[model samples]
Target: MLKGGCRLNGKKRCLLPLLLAGVLFSCTVTFSAAKKIPTILVCPKTLDNSFWGNVRAGAMTAGKEYGASVIWKGPTVETDIAGQLAIMEDFVNKRVDAIALAATDVKALYAPVKKALNAKIPVVSFDSGLDPDPTLCLIATDNYKGAFEAGEALARLIGQKGKIACIPLISGASTSILREKGFNAAIARYPGIRLVAVQYSESDVAKGMAVAENILTANPDLDGIFAANEPGAMGAAQAVKARGLSGKVKLVAFDASPMEIEMLQNGTIQALIVQNPYNMGYLAVKTCIEALNGKKVPKRIDTGVAVVTMDNFYEPKIQQLLYPAGNSGK
Candidate 1:
């Protein structure tokens, strides 16, 4: 009986070893088959502007929702094309799953974007798009439409036919170029309205203010002004105010900075064409994730636009998207 008992104990020990081996093999297979979440790199023009901050928030939201890591990095200034290119290259070298960029120079970014594509890393352009490569998906506002609306608003404010000057941040940047084209096209509809001058400020607030000052001095009869972005608009408004012509000259600007919104409320500025920057950031990341999953995303996604004035500026929907709880002035 004792011998028989020892044999049964030995058999139980053998079975235990088999069970442990089976469990270890199953765990290894499970880990190997687990899905790997892709990492997304977001390279904005700059983080100093509130507009880009909204974009970063949007990208973060998408990153959280999709279980992906997001790296938001960019130059402190807008004109840092070389800095932007370096960031793109870094992402490519790290073998990031994807990159979303707001190109400082559309033509200058072609080589870098192409290199990313060659490495099988997908590239998406947000805010400012690349013109060279047809494969890059672009997520941005319909700048022309938004700028046209702004021009119409300015024309209405001016009432009589007069000369309007435009101070754009950058001459050749895709967004500014589109805005200039749209503004010119719309202003052309009104026979009395004329674009007197177009100046490039290099996206510098101080330079924009100085340029506006010079233009105002050169053409005191300038009845209206359009700024392609928030900083440009604010700087131009300051120049107009310094000359004691705030309400006298109609100002139509882009981007709804807190100061800009306040100006709109106080009647300092007539109108603002606000871009859905948050949506642009969010959609850029979402599209990238979709692409990674082999899902088709549209090459050009218009994140949409809004025209804000004192009347409906405080609307709940716009406030929730633009100002959110902690970010709002009030």
Candidate 2:
């Protein structure tokens, strides 16, 4: 029915329809403008840990630097391959300008990555990757080398004459595989150091602790232990503390966590294999943006790693790697 001007039963002619039309037109213009600016999606292993938090921050910082809209999200934890794959598929369908992925599983993610590439989306793998393809551009720590250093550090700390064990993050994780290889290589050099046991933590803290406890029980004379990643390290540290083996166990671990830092201060772990996760995040986004802008980017970027012992813990460089953006809230 008709009313005053263009509305029915309204005192002031119900301008609602005209107002909505104006708003719709304005929204369309804004959206069209937004589409012109490139959109990048940065998907990490998870958002729960301090490691991934810094990754997220560095990625957003680069996004702001490059004037690109960045969407940072992933599974709740590192083990959720299906969740990560779904996000990739969604981004592919949306035709995102590019994607930076820290793959959940090495081989499982290869197909999804190829799918994104086929859909004309540039993909950059950071922190970890699918395969040994430098063409995809991997921004990550030199895991094998770093792990070898950790192994040597541990051997020296233990005087290379006792049984030791390794608690890896997971079996199929590329980082885990490389670190394991490097560790084996290092251990071979120390004949006096016997490899009594090796366990997989499935990237779970509790499992890491349980595995540590079991290994310690099975070999009470165990001299040293290496934890492959943050969670396993934390779990191993816990197990050592629980058994009152803190200083006696000669623990060496990878990555940095609040608990790990506390352990370092308290003498739970003799050394930490620290990686530059923040740089990995920043550079991944930067590379993706550059590619979108038609700039050629390198396919392999080692973000680098270092051994953080008490001797070098307070140094400026180690401080930056230990605490990126001066925030270690985890």
Candidate 3:
């Protein structure tokens, strides 16, 4: 007597239906074991911020739709270049099917990115990118243009003539560099505007606040400020609010984090240069999947940016930008 009430001692006496059922079960198990879902690794500069959280949401949404496993990982802080590189190397060693990276350091990421490419893994960059652009596709906002628009807006808020300062996220980062340049170029257009100081926040709120405080202390006559990223914006807004200069010192910052939006509403931040991080993450994953499927993807995809102010905050399009359905605009 065997498990299905079939005697195995004499094979010819066994029930044909039971034997066929057992064979079918074994075949089904084997087939199920053979199929494997593709895995995609999405690495942002840091994982602690709401901006990155929104990006993660978008990436995960795309992963679910495309039937690929999404692994979201990154350093706790944006300045941890070594940590990011290590994470990338480990994932490459694990042989993930694809990688979407918002690299912390432009030059340091090339080696691991190159290795992943050599191993036939597709790498897509988002938010920030590598120096030489080794990734198959770059899905991100046009940082330069966004910053330029922010500068123009800030200048307008200050009546186009006043002392200003800049708080950029990371000095050596590609996005930071481009943003700073664009901001300076825009400021250059208005000869009456004077850039009084510049500082690097490393995308840390406290650091941004400290720098903003110092800039304010050094130049009491400063009329406007531009903080290049979300954390920077929060810090600058706090500094301005604390100094009782909410309206006195005009502030235009980047990214529409909840805190930033609140500041904008309260007039602490006059305007926000909003980037579609959700789109960046979504497109990064989508592009990676396309590349893995042997389809050609564009070398670059601009997720686009928008400037938001109190005047048009309630508009339907701005509301959509601020609160994308699945994303809380974190």
Best by TM-score: 1
Where does model 2 exceed 4 Å of error? 1-35, 132-135, 327-330
What's the CA RMSD for each of the models? 3.1, 8.3, 4.9
Task: Give the least accurate 10-residue stretch of model 3, judged by summed lDDT.
Answer: 321-330
TM-score, prediction 3? 0.90
Q: What order do you get sorting by TM-score, best first? A: 1, 3, 2
TM-scores of all models? 0.91, 0.87, 0.90
Report the error of model 1 at residue 142, Å.
Answer: 0.4
* Model 2 lDDT tens row, 1-330: 563465455735576778889999999999988677789989988877778887888898998998889999898877898999899889888999899998888988888788888887889999888865433589999999999998899999999888999998877788889999999899889889999999998788898999999999999999999999988999899999999999999999998877788899899998999888878889999999888878888878999989998888888878878887675433
Query: Could you tell which candidate, 1 or 3, scores higher by lDDT?
Result: 3
Candidate 1 residue-wise lDDT, 239-284, digit = tens: 9888889899889999987888888877778888888888888899
Q: What is the C-alpha lDDT of each candidate?
A: 0.85, 0.87, 0.91
lDDT of 3 by residue, 157-274 (tens): 9898989999999978999999999999999999999998999988999999999999999999999999999999899999999999999999999998888988988889999998
Q: What is the Cα-based lDDT of residue 206 in candidate 3?
A: 95
